[model samples]
Target: MMPASSATLHVVATPIGNLGDLSPRAQEVLRTVAAICAEDTRHTGQLLSQFGIATPLLALHDHNEEAIAGRLVARLLAGESLALVSDAGTPLVSDPGFRLVRAARAAGVRVSPVPGACAAIAALSVAGLPSDRFVFEGFLPAKAAARRERLQRLAGETGTLVFYESSHRIADSLADMVQAFGAARPAVVARELTKLFETVLDGDLEALLAAVQADGNQRKGEFVVMVQGAGDDEDAKVAEGRRLYARLNEHLPPSTAAKLAADLSGAPRKALYGG
Candidate 1:
Protein backbone atom coordinates (compact mmCIF):
# COMPACT_ATOMS: atom_id res chain seq x y z
CA MET A 1 0.00 0.00 0.00
CA MET A 2 1.25 3.45 -0.84
CA PRO A 3 1.66 5.88 2.03
CA ALA A 4 -0.67 8.78 2.75
CA SER A 5 1.78 11.12 1.05
CA SER A 6 1.23 9.68 -2.46
CA ALA A 7 1.91 12.30 -5.08
CA THR A 8 -0.88 14.08 -6.96
CA LEU A 9 -1.59 14.14 -10.66
CA HIS A 10 -2.59 17.61 -11.87
CA VAL A 11 -4.62 17.55 -15.09
CA VAL A 12 -3.88 20.96 -16.60
CA ALA A 13 -5.65 22.87 -19.35
CA THR A 14 -3.56 24.84 -21.82
CA PRO A 15 -4.58 27.57 -24.21
CA ILE A 16 -6.59 26.51 -27.25
CA GLY A 17 -5.09 29.38 -29.30
CA ASN A 18 -4.28 32.61 -27.47
CA LEU A 19 -1.21 32.38 -25.22
CA GLY A 20 -2.78 34.82 -22.74
CA ASP A 21 -5.49 32.27 -21.83
CA LEU A 22 -3.00 30.11 -19.93
CA SER A 23 -3.87 30.82 -16.31
CA PRO A 24 -1.30 31.86 -13.70
CA ARG A 25 -1.98 28.74 -11.59
CA ALA A 26 -1.43 26.52 -14.63
CA GLN A 27 1.94 28.15 -15.19
CA GLU A 28 2.89 27.56 -11.56
CA VAL A 29 1.84 23.90 -11.80
CA LEU A 30 3.87 23.47 -14.99
CA ARG A 31 6.85 25.07 -13.27
CA THR A 32 6.74 23.03 -10.05
CA VAL A 33 5.79 19.58 -11.30
CA ALA A 34 8.51 16.93 -11.42
CA ALA A 35 7.68 16.39 -15.09
CA ILE A 36 4.80 17.26 -17.38
CA CYS A 37 3.15 14.52 -19.44
CA ALA A 38 2.22 16.04 -22.80
CA GLU A 39 0.48 14.76 -25.92
CA ASP A 40 3.21 16.36 -28.00
CA THR A 41 6.40 17.36 -26.23
CA ARG A 42 7.54 19.75 -28.94
CA HIS A 43 4.23 21.63 -29.03
CA THR A 44 4.10 21.75 -25.25
CA GLY A 45 7.76 22.73 -25.16
CA GLN A 46 7.07 25.74 -27.33
CA LEU A 47 4.26 26.77 -24.99
CA LEU A 48 6.40 26.33 -21.88
CA SER A 49 9.36 28.14 -23.37
CA GLN A 50 7.17 31.16 -24.03
CA PHE A 51 6.59 31.47 -20.28
CA GLY A 52 10.09 30.28 -19.25
CA ILE A 53 8.81 27.09 -17.63
CA ALA A 54 11.69 24.62 -17.90
CA THR A 55 10.03 21.50 -16.49
CA PRO A 56 11.07 18.41 -18.39
CA LEU A 57 8.37 16.88 -20.62
CA LEU A 58 7.51 13.21 -21.06
CA ALA A 59 5.62 12.25 -24.18
CA LEU A 60 2.20 10.71 -23.47
CA HIS A 61 -0.17 10.62 -26.40
CA ASP A 62 -2.81 8.39 -28.00
CA HIS A 63 -0.26 6.01 -29.55
CA ASN A 64 1.79 5.51 -26.39
CA GLU A 65 -0.49 6.44 -23.48
CA GLU A 66 -1.61 2.91 -22.56
CA ALA A 67 1.96 1.61 -22.50
CA ILE A 68 3.23 4.46 -20.29
CA ALA A 69 0.29 5.07 -17.92
CA GLY A 70 1.38 2.37 -15.50
CA ARG A 71 4.88 3.76 -15.34
CA LEU A 72 3.53 7.27 -14.73
CA VAL A 73 1.24 5.97 -11.99
CA ALA A 74 4.21 4.21 -10.36
CA ARG A 75 6.03 7.53 -10.30
CA LEU A 76 3.02 9.12 -8.61
CA LEU A 77 3.05 6.39 -5.99
CA ALA A 78 6.71 7.19 -5.44
CA GLY A 79 5.88 10.69 -4.19
CA GLU A 80 6.75 12.63 -7.36
CA SER A 81 3.87 14.90 -8.34
CA LEU A 82 3.28 15.22 -12.08
CA ALA A 83 1.11 17.30 -14.42
CA LEU A 84 -0.64 16.07 -17.57
CA VAL A 85 -1.37 18.44 -20.45
CA SER A 86 -2.64 18.21 -23.99
CA ASP A 87 -1.29 20.30 -26.86
CA ALA A 88 -4.16 22.70 -26.23
CA GLY A 89 -7.39 23.09 -24.26
CA THR A 90 -8.46 20.87 -21.38
CA PRO A 91 -6.72 17.51 -21.06
CA LEU A 92 -8.78 14.41 -22.02
CA VAL A 93 -11.61 16.48 -23.53
CA SER A 94 -11.22 15.03 -27.02
CA ASP A 95 -7.51 15.01 -26.14
CA PRO A 96 -5.18 12.41 -24.65
CA GLY A 97 -4.34 11.68 -20.95
CA PHE A 98 -7.40 9.52 -20.09
CA ARG A 99 -5.33 6.43 -19.41
CA LEU A 100 -2.84 8.21 -17.15
CA VAL A 101 -5.57 9.96 -15.16
CA ARG A 102 -7.55 6.71 -14.77
CA ALA A 103 -4.45 4.77 -13.72
CA ALA A 104 -3.46 7.41 -11.20
CA ARG A 105 -6.91 7.31 -9.57
CA ALA A 106 -6.98 3.51 -9.60
CA ALA A 107 -3.61 3.43 -7.85
CA GLY A 108 -4.84 5.64 -4.96
CA VAL A 109 -3.14 8.77 -6.27
CA ARG A 110 -5.15 11.98 -6.08
CA VAL A 111 -6.10 13.53 -9.45
CA SER A 112 -7.03 17.22 -9.71
CA PRO A 113 -8.09 19.42 -12.60
CA VAL A 114 -6.71 22.88 -13.48
CA PRO A 115 -9.35 23.99 -15.96
CA GLY A 116 -8.85 26.82 -18.45
CA ALA A 117 -9.57 27.15 -22.16
CA CYS A 118 -11.73 24.49 -23.84
CA ALA A 119 -12.69 25.09 -27.47
CA ALA A 120 -16.07 23.37 -27.13
CA ILE A 121 -17.08 25.46 -24.11
CA ALA A 122 -15.57 28.61 -25.58
CA ALA A 123 -17.55 28.20 -28.78
CA LEU A 124 -20.71 27.35 -26.87
CA SER A 125 -20.37 30.55 -24.85
CA VAL A 126 -20.67 32.63 -28.01
CA ALA A 127 -23.22 30.39 -29.70
CA GLY A 128 -26.71 31.91 -29.12
CA LEU A 129 -28.23 28.44 -28.96
CA PRO A 130 -29.67 26.99 -25.79
CA SER A 131 -27.02 26.39 -23.14
CA ASP A 132 -29.30 24.85 -20.49
CA ARG A 133 -28.73 21.34 -21.84
CA PHE A 134 -26.25 20.35 -24.54
CA VAL A 135 -24.18 17.46 -25.81
CA PHE A 136 -20.51 17.57 -26.81
CA GLU A 137 -19.75 15.15 -29.61
CA GLY A 138 -15.97 15.41 -29.77
CA PHE A 139 -15.41 15.00 -33.51
CA LEU A 140 -17.56 13.44 -36.17
CA PRO A 141 -16.33 10.39 -38.09
CA ALA A 142 -13.83 11.34 -40.79
CA LYS A 143 -15.44 9.44 -43.68
CA ALA A 144 -18.41 10.94 -45.49
CA ALA A 145 -20.87 8.02 -45.31
CA ALA A 146 -20.10 7.36 -41.68
CA ARG A 147 -20.42 11.03 -40.81
CA ARG A 148 -23.82 11.30 -42.46
CA GLU A 149 -25.00 8.15 -40.73
CA ARG A 150 -24.03 9.60 -37.37
CA LEU A 151 -25.86 12.85 -38.08
CA GLN A 152 -28.98 10.95 -39.09
CA ARG A 153 -29.02 9.21 -35.74
CA LEU A 154 -28.93 12.52 -33.89
CA ALA A 155 -31.59 14.28 -35.97
CA GLY A 156 -34.17 14.07 -33.23
CA GLU A 157 -32.01 15.10 -30.29
CA THR A 158 -33.66 17.75 -28.12
CA GLY A 159 -30.50 19.21 -26.59
CA THR A 160 -28.11 21.43 -28.52
CA LEU A 161 -25.52 19.36 -30.38
CA VAL A 162 -21.87 20.42 -30.27
CA PHE A 163 -19.15 18.92 -32.44
CA TYR A 164 -15.52 19.75 -33.13
CA GLU A 165 -14.33 19.60 -36.71
CA SER A 166 -11.15 20.22 -38.68
CA SER A 167 -10.95 22.92 -41.35
CA HIS A 168 -10.94 20.45 -44.25
CA ARG A 169 -14.22 18.75 -43.31
CA ILE A 170 -16.26 21.74 -42.18
CA ALA A 171 -18.00 22.30 -45.52
CA ASP A 172 -18.85 18.66 -46.18
CA SER A 173 -20.04 18.07 -42.63
CA LEU A 174 -22.33 21.07 -42.77
CA ALA A 175 -23.74 19.88 -46.08
CA ASP A 176 -24.41 16.46 -44.63
CA MET A 177 -26.05 18.08 -41.63
CA VAL A 178 -28.40 20.03 -43.90
CA GLN A 179 -29.36 16.79 -45.60
CA ALA A 180 -29.92 14.88 -42.40
CA PHE A 181 -31.41 17.60 -40.22
CA GLY A 182 -33.09 19.70 -42.92
CA ALA A 183 -32.03 22.90 -44.70
CA ALA A 184 -33.80 25.19 -42.23
CA ARG A 185 -32.23 23.81 -39.03
CA PRO A 186 -30.51 26.57 -37.06
CA ALA A 187 -26.77 26.21 -36.47
CA VAL A 188 -23.60 28.14 -35.70
CA VAL A 189 -20.07 27.55 -36.90
CA ALA A 190 -17.45 28.97 -34.59
CA ARG A 191 -14.04 29.01 -36.27
CA GLU A 192 -10.54 29.51 -34.87
CA LEU A 193 -11.93 30.44 -31.47
CA THR A 194 -9.89 32.94 -29.43
CA LYS A 195 -7.44 33.30 -32.31
CA LEU A 196 -6.95 36.46 -34.34
CA PHE A 197 -9.05 35.32 -37.32
CA GLU A 198 -11.90 33.91 -35.26
CA THR A 199 -15.36 34.03 -36.82
CA VAL A 200 -18.70 32.78 -35.53
CA LEU A 201 -21.30 32.28 -38.25
CA ASP A 202 -25.02 31.94 -37.56
CA GLY A 203 -27.85 30.87 -39.88
CA ASP A 204 -29.90 27.95 -41.04
CA LEU A 205 -27.84 24.91 -42.10
CA GLU A 206 -28.33 25.72 -45.82
CA ALA A 207 -27.17 29.31 -45.49
CA LEU A 208 -24.18 28.30 -43.37
CA LEU A 209 -23.15 25.72 -45.98
CA ALA A 210 -23.47 28.32 -48.74
CA ALA A 211 -21.36 30.77 -46.77
CA VAL A 212 -18.64 28.18 -46.15
CA GLN A 213 -18.59 27.15 -49.81
CA ALA A 214 -18.50 30.74 -51.05
CA ASP A 215 -15.85 32.04 -48.68
CA GLY A 216 -12.59 30.10 -48.71
CA ASN A 217 -11.50 31.68 -45.43
CA GLN A 218 -14.65 30.46 -43.64
CA ARG A 219 -13.57 26.88 -44.18
CA LYS A 220 -9.97 27.38 -43.05
CA GLY A 221 -9.90 27.00 -39.28
CA GLU A 222 -10.61 24.56 -36.44
CA PHE A 223 -14.41 24.54 -35.95
CA VAL A 224 -16.97 24.04 -33.25
CA VAL A 225 -20.26 23.38 -35.05
CA MET A 226 -23.32 23.81 -32.86
CA VAL A 227 -26.86 22.94 -33.92
CA GLN A 228 -30.12 23.86 -32.25
CA GLY A 229 -32.18 20.91 -31.03
CA ALA A 230 -35.06 19.30 -32.89
CA GLY A 231 -38.26 21.27 -32.37
CA ASP A 232 -41.38 20.45 -30.34
CA ASP A 233 -43.14 17.09 -30.17
CA GLU A 234 -45.27 17.86 -33.24
CA ASP A 235 -42.20 18.61 -35.29
CA ALA A 236 -40.49 15.41 -34.19
CA LYS A 237 -43.58 13.41 -34.99
CA VAL A 238 -43.85 14.92 -38.45
CA ALA A 239 -40.22 14.06 -39.15
CA GLU A 240 -40.66 10.50 -37.93
CA GLY A 241 -43.91 10.19 -39.84
CA ARG A 242 -42.28 11.21 -43.08
CA ARG A 243 -39.47 8.74 -42.55
CA LEU A 244 -41.90 5.94 -41.87
CA TYR A 245 -44.17 6.85 -44.80
CA ALA A 246 -41.26 6.50 -47.23
CA ARG A 247 -40.56 2.94 -46.15
CA LEU A 248 -44.19 1.89 -45.76
CA ASN A 249 -45.23 3.27 -49.15
CA GLU A 250 -42.90 0.80 -50.87
CA HIS A 251 -45.28 -2.05 -49.98
CA LEU A 252 -48.63 -0.46 -49.18
CA PRO A 253 -50.70 2.00 -51.21
CA PRO A 254 -49.68 5.64 -50.63
CA SER A 255 -52.90 6.51 -48.75
CA THR A 256 -52.69 3.35 -46.63
CA ALA A 257 -49.03 3.99 -45.79
CA ALA A 258 -49.72 7.57 -44.81
CA LYS A 259 -52.56 6.52 -42.51
CA LEU A 260 -50.43 3.83 -40.86
CA ALA A 261 -47.40 6.09 -40.47
CA ALA A 262 -49.44 8.96 -39.07
CA ASP A 263 -51.00 6.61 -36.54
CA LEU A 264 -47.68 5.12 -35.53
CA SER A 265 -45.76 8.37 -35.31
CA GLY A 266 -48.51 10.51 -33.75
CA ALA A 267 -48.39 12.94 -36.70
CA PRO A 268 -51.38 14.33 -38.58
CA ARG A 269 -52.43 12.22 -41.57
CA LYS A 270 -52.60 15.28 -43.86
CA ALA A 271 -48.90 15.97 -43.37
CA LEU A 272 -47.85 12.48 -44.52
CA TYR A 273 -50.61 11.79 -47.06
CA GLY A 274 -49.51 14.19 -49.82
CA GLY A 275 -45.96 12.88 -50.32
Candidate 2:
Protein backbone atom coordinates (compact mmCIF):
# COMPACT_ATOMS: atom_id res chain seq x y z
CA MET A 1 0.00 0.00 0.00
CA MET A 2 1.23 3.51 -0.72
CA PRO A 3 1.90 5.70 2.29
CA ALA A 4 -0.83 8.05 3.43
CA SER A 5 1.58 11.00 3.21
CA SER A 6 2.18 9.99 -0.39
CA ALA A 7 -1.35 10.99 -1.31
CA THR A 8 0.02 12.94 -4.23
CA LEU A 9 0.21 12.90 -7.99
CA HIS A 10 2.46 10.15 -9.36
CA VAL A 11 3.77 10.23 -12.90
CA VAL A 12 4.35 6.53 -13.52
CA ALA A 13 6.24 4.85 -16.29
CA THR A 14 4.98 1.54 -17.58
CA PRO A 15 6.66 -1.02 -19.86
CA ILE A 16 7.96 0.33 -23.12
CA GLY A 17 7.59 -2.99 -24.95
CA ASN A 18 8.21 -5.86 -22.56
CA LEU A 19 5.79 -6.00 -19.63
CA GLY A 20 8.54 -7.31 -17.35
CA ASP A 21 10.33 -3.94 -17.32
CA LEU A 22 7.55 -2.44 -15.25
CA SER A 23 9.11 -1.68 -11.87
CA PRO A 24 7.71 -2.89 -8.56
CA ARG A 25 7.45 0.66 -7.20
CA ALA A 26 5.72 1.83 -10.34
CA GLN A 27 3.30 -1.05 -10.06
CA GLU A 28 2.76 -0.34 -6.41
CA VAL A 29 1.84 3.22 -7.23
CA LEU A 30 -0.34 2.04 -10.08
CA ARG A 31 -2.29 -0.38 -7.90
CA THR A 32 -2.86 2.26 -5.28
CA VAL A 33 -3.31 5.56 -7.17
CA ALA A 34 -6.87 6.67 -6.24
CA ALA A 35 -7.36 7.17 -9.95
CA ILE A 36 -5.22 7.23 -13.08
CA CYS A 37 -5.20 9.69 -15.97
CA ALA A 38 -4.36 7.55 -18.97
CA GLU A 39 -3.67 8.74 -22.47
CA ASP A 40 -6.09 6.08 -23.58
CA THR A 41 -8.22 4.12 -21.11
CA ARG A 42 -8.60 1.10 -23.37
CA HIS A 43 -4.87 1.01 -23.98
CA THR A 44 -4.10 1.45 -20.30
CA GLY A 45 -6.79 -1.12 -19.51
CA GLN A 46 -4.83 -3.74 -21.38
CA LEU A 47 -1.75 -2.86 -19.33
CA LEU A 48 -3.62 -2.88 -16.02
CA SER A 49 -5.21 -6.21 -16.92
CA GLN A 50 -1.72 -7.72 -16.86
CA PHE A 51 -1.24 -6.97 -13.15
CA GLY A 52 -4.92 -7.20 -12.26
CA ILE A 53 -4.97 -3.53 -11.34
CA ALA A 54 -8.60 -2.41 -11.30
CA THR A 55 -8.10 1.30 -10.65
CA PRO A 56 -10.39 3.52 -12.72
CA LEU A 57 -8.68 5.26 -15.63
CA LEU A 58 -9.43 8.66 -17.16
CA ALA A 59 -8.61 9.25 -20.79
CA LEU A 60 -6.55 12.45 -21.09
CA HIS A 61 -5.01 12.46 -24.51
CA ASP A 62 -3.97 15.43 -26.71
CA HIS A 63 -7.51 16.14 -27.83
CA ASN A 64 -9.05 16.05 -24.37
CA GLU A 65 -6.36 17.30 -21.97
CA GLU A 66 -7.65 20.87 -21.89
CA ALA A 67 -11.25 19.83 -21.46
CA ILE A 68 -10.46 17.58 -18.49
CA ALA A 69 -7.59 19.54 -16.95
CA GLY A 70 -9.80 21.48 -14.53
CA ARG A 71 -11.58 18.46 -13.07
CA LEU A 72 -8.30 16.63 -12.62
CA VAL A 73 -6.86 19.69 -10.93
CA ALA A 74 -9.83 20.00 -8.57
CA ARG A 75 -9.57 16.30 -7.65
CA LEU A 76 -5.88 16.55 -6.89
CA LEU A 77 -6.45 19.69 -4.85
CA ALA A 78 -9.02 17.82 -2.79
CA GLY A 79 -6.17 15.50 -1.72
CA GLU A 80 -7.20 12.72 -4.06
CA SER A 81 -4.07 10.85 -5.20
CA LEU A 82 -3.71 10.08 -8.86
CA ALA A 83 -1.24 8.39 -11.14
CA LEU A 84 -0.59 9.48 -14.69
CA VAL A 85 0.46 6.79 -17.13
CA SER A 86 0.89 6.92 -20.86
CA ASP A 87 -0.06 4.00 -23.10
CA ALA A 88 3.61 3.09 -22.72
CA GLY A 89 6.84 4.48 -21.34
CA THR A 90 7.28 7.58 -19.14
CA PRO A 91 4.35 9.96 -18.95
CA LEU A 92 4.80 13.47 -20.42
CA VAL A 93 7.81 12.49 -22.53
CA SER A 94 5.78 13.15 -25.70
CA ASP A 95 2.48 12.42 -24.06
CA PRO A 96 -0.49 14.52 -22.95
CA GLY A 97 0.00 14.50 -19.18
CA PHE A 98 1.90 17.78 -19.19
CA ARG A 99 -1.12 20.01 -18.60
CA LEU A 100 -2.23 17.96 -15.63
CA VAL A 101 1.31 17.81 -14.31
CA ARG A 102 1.59 21.55 -14.62
CA ALA A 103 -1.76 22.06 -12.99
CA ALA A 104 -0.87 19.78 -10.11
CA ARG A 105 2.32 21.68 -9.57
CA ALA A 106 0.55 24.99 -9.72
CA ALA A 107 -1.94 23.81 -7.11
CA GLY A 108 0.89 22.99 -4.65
CA VAL A 109 0.13 19.30 -4.89
CA ARG A 110 3.04 16.94 -4.42
CA VAL A 111 4.05 15.26 -7.64
CA SER A 112 6.19 12.13 -7.58
CA PRO A 113 7.63 10.20 -10.48
CA VAL A 114 7.56 6.41 -10.76
CA PRO A 115 10.08 6.12 -13.50
CA GLY A 116 10.49 3.00 -15.62
CA ALA A 117 10.75 1.95 -19.28
CA CYS A 118 11.05 4.75 -21.87
CA ALA A 119 11.05 4.05 -25.61
CA ALA A 120 13.73 6.61 -26.47
CA ILE A 121 15.97 5.30 -23.72
CA ALA A 122 15.17 1.73 -24.71
CA ALA A 123 16.26 2.39 -28.28
CA LEU A 124 19.32 4.34 -27.12
CA SER A 125 20.31 1.39 -24.92
CA VAL A 126 21.45 -0.79 -27.83
CA ALA A 127 21.63 1.84 -30.56
CA GLY A 128 25.46 1.88 -30.19
CA LEU A 129 25.27 5.64 -30.67
CA PRO A 130 26.79 8.19 -28.32
CA SER A 131 24.70 8.59 -25.21
CA ASP A 132 26.64 11.62 -23.94
CA ARG A 133 24.32 14.28 -25.34
CA PHE A 134 21.32 13.47 -27.47
CA VAL A 135 18.21 15.23 -28.68
CA PHE A 136 14.80 13.62 -29.03
CA GLU A 137 12.96 14.80 -32.14
CA GLY A 138 9.81 12.97 -31.36
CA PHE A 139 7.74 11.83 -34.33
CA LEU A 140 8.63 14.10 -37.22
CA PRO A 141 6.13 16.29 -39.06
CA ALA A 142 3.68 14.18 -41.03
CA LYS A 143 4.12 16.36 -44.10
CA ALA A 144 7.15 15.56 -46.24
CA ALA A 145 8.22 19.15 -46.81
CA ALA A 146 7.98 20.11 -43.15
CA ARG A 147 9.71 16.89 -42.10
CA ARG A 148 12.51 17.47 -44.61
CA GLU A 149 12.97 21.04 -43.42
CA ARG A 150 13.19 19.88 -39.83
CA LEU A 151 15.62 17.12 -40.83
CA GLN A 152 17.72 19.55 -42.82
CA ARG A 153 18.03 21.82 -39.81
CA LEU A 154 19.57 19.09 -37.64
CA ALA A 155 21.76 17.35 -40.19
CA GLY A 156 25.17 18.06 -38.74
CA GLU A 157 24.41 18.62 -35.07
CA THR A 158 27.35 17.34 -32.99
CA GLY A 159 25.34 15.11 -30.71
CA THR A 160 23.43 11.90 -31.12
CA LEU A 161 20.09 12.69 -32.80
CA VAL A 162 17.05 10.56 -32.12
CA PHE A 163 13.82 10.58 -34.11
CA TYR A 164 10.63 8.51 -33.83
CA GLU A 165 9.24 7.43 -37.20
CA SER A 166 6.14 5.42 -37.99
CA SER A 167 6.05 2.43 -40.34
CA HIS A 168 4.01 4.14 -43.05
CA ARG A 169 6.47 7.02 -43.39
CA ILE A 170 9.66 5.22 -42.38
CA ALA A 171 10.90 4.86 -45.94
CA ASP A 172 10.25 8.46 -46.83
CA SER A 173 11.71 9.60 -43.51
CA LEU A 174 14.84 7.52 -44.07
CA ALA A 175 15.19 8.94 -47.55
CA ASP A 176 15.00 12.52 -46.20
CA MET A 177 17.45 11.53 -43.48
CA VAL A 178 19.85 10.36 -46.20
CA GLN A 179 19.50 13.66 -48.02
CA ALA A 180 20.07 15.74 -44.91
CA PHE A 181 22.13 13.57 -42.53
CA GLY A 182 24.02 12.17 -45.54
CA ALA A 183 24.41 8.73 -47.06
CA ALA A 184 27.58 7.95 -45.07
CA ARG A 185 26.48 9.19 -41.64
CA PRO A 186 26.41 6.33 -39.15
CA ALA A 187 22.89 5.55 -37.91
CA VAL A 188 20.89 2.89 -36.15
CA VAL A 189 17.25 2.02 -36.65
CA ALA A 190 16.00 0.26 -33.55
CA ARG A 191 12.50 -1.22 -33.60
CA GLU A 192 10.43 -3.44 -31.32
CA LEU A 193 13.07 -3.31 -28.64
CA THR A 194 12.49 -5.88 -25.94
CA LYS A 195 9.53 -7.20 -27.94
CA LEU A 196 9.16 -9.96 -30.45
CA PHE A 197 10.72 -9.48 -33.91
CA GLU A 198 13.08 -6.98 -32.30
CA THR A 199 15.51 -5.58 -34.86
CA VAL A 200 18.41 -3.16 -34.73
CA LEU A 201 20.17 -2.19 -37.92
CA ASP A 202 23.37 -0.23 -37.40
CA GLY A 203 25.12 1.08 -40.48
CA ASP A 204 25.69 4.15 -42.63
CA LEU A 205 22.52 5.80 -43.86
CA GLU A 206 22.80 4.39 -47.40
CA ALA A 207 23.32 0.81 -46.25
CA LEU A 208 20.57 1.06 -43.64
CA LEU A 209 18.21 2.61 -46.19
CA ALA A 210 19.03 -0.10 -48.73
CA ALA A 211 18.55 -2.82 -46.14
CA VAL A 212 15.20 -1.41 -45.11
CA GLN A 213 14.21 -1.20 -48.77
CA ALA A 214 15.35 -4.69 -49.69
CA ASP A 215 13.33 -6.55 -47.08
CA GLY A 216 9.59 -6.42 -46.56
CA ASN A 217 10.25 -7.88 -43.13
CA GLN A 218 12.45 -4.89 -42.15
CA ARG A 219 9.66 -2.40 -42.73
CA LYS A 220 7.42 -3.24 -39.82
CA GLY A 221 7.30 -2.08 -36.19
CA GLU A 222 7.66 1.23 -34.33
CA PHE A 223 11.06 2.83 -34.89
CA VAL A 224 13.65 5.04 -33.24
CA VAL A 225 16.36 6.30 -35.55
CA MET A 226 19.64 7.23 -33.87
CA VAL A 227 22.16 9.16 -35.94
CA GLN A 228 25.80 9.66 -34.99
CA GLY A 229 26.99 13.24 -34.75
CA ALA A 230 29.40 15.03 -37.01
CA GLY A 231 33.08 14.21 -36.62
CA ASP A 232 36.15 16.48 -36.60
CA ASP A 233 38.52 17.10 -39.51
CA GLU A 234 37.96 20.39 -41.33
CA ASP A 235 38.20 18.85 -44.79
CA ALA A 236 36.04 15.89 -43.89
CA LYS A 237 33.46 18.33 -42.58
CA VAL A 238 33.64 20.27 -45.83
CA ALA A 239 33.31 17.04 -47.77
CA GLU A 240 30.10 16.30 -45.91
CA GLY A 241 28.94 19.82 -46.68
CA ARG A 242 29.89 19.35 -50.34
CA ARG A 243 27.77 16.23 -50.46
CA LEU A 244 24.75 18.18 -49.22
CA TYR A 245 25.60 21.01 -51.58
CA ALA A 246 25.71 18.53 -54.45
CA ARG A 247 22.18 17.39 -53.69
CA LEU A 248 20.86 20.91 -53.15
CA ASN A 249 22.62 22.41 -56.18
CA GLU A 250 20.90 19.89 -58.42
CA HIS A 251 17.60 21.58 -57.59
CA LEU A 252 18.78 24.95 -56.34
CA PRO A 253 21.10 27.84 -57.15
CA PRO A 254 24.80 28.30 -56.22
CA SER A 255 23.79 30.76 -53.51
CA THR A 256 21.92 27.90 -51.91
CA ALA A 257 25.24 26.20 -51.14
CA ALA A 258 25.60 28.05 -47.82
CA LYS A 259 22.24 26.85 -46.50
CA LEU A 260 22.91 23.28 -47.65
CA ALA A 261 26.48 23.36 -46.32
CA ALA A 262 25.36 24.73 -42.98
CA ASP A 263 22.88 21.86 -42.69
CA LEU A 264 25.67 19.33 -43.26
CA SER A 265 28.25 20.99 -41.03
CA GLY A 266 28.17 21.97 -37.39
CA ALA A 267 30.17 25.03 -38.41
CA PRO A 268 28.72 28.52 -38.66
CA ARG A 269 26.94 29.44 -41.87
CA LYS A 270 29.21 32.45 -42.27
CA ALA A 271 32.28 30.30 -41.64
CA LEU A 272 31.16 27.68 -44.16
CA TYR A 273 32.44 29.27 -47.40
CA GLY A 274 31.97 32.63 -45.66
CA GLY A 275 28.21 32.45 -46.24
Q: Pick the candidate with the highest lDDT.
A: 1
Per-residue lDDT of model 2, residues 250-272, tens digit only: 68776677686667664455544
Q: What's the TM-score of every candidate structure?
A: 0.90, 0.86
52 Cα displacement, candidate 2 (Å)? 1.0
What is the model-wide C-alpha lDDT for candidate 1?
A: 0.90
Per-residue error for 74 in candidate 2, Å, reads 1.0
The models' CA-based lDDT, in order, is: 0.90, 0.82
Best by TM-score: 1
- Compared with the true structure, what per-residue lDDT tens digits does model 1 show for residues 1-275? 65344688999999989999999999999999999999999999999999999999999999999999989888888899999999899999999988888888888898999989999999999999999999999899999878966887777787899999998999999999987677898999999999999999999999999999999999897999999988899777776776677668889999999999899989899977765
The ten-residue window of minimal lDDT in model 1 covers 1-10
**Deviation of model 1 at 51, angstroms:** 0.3
Query: How many backbone clashes are present in model 2?
Result: 0
Off by over 4 Å in 2: 1-6, 233-275
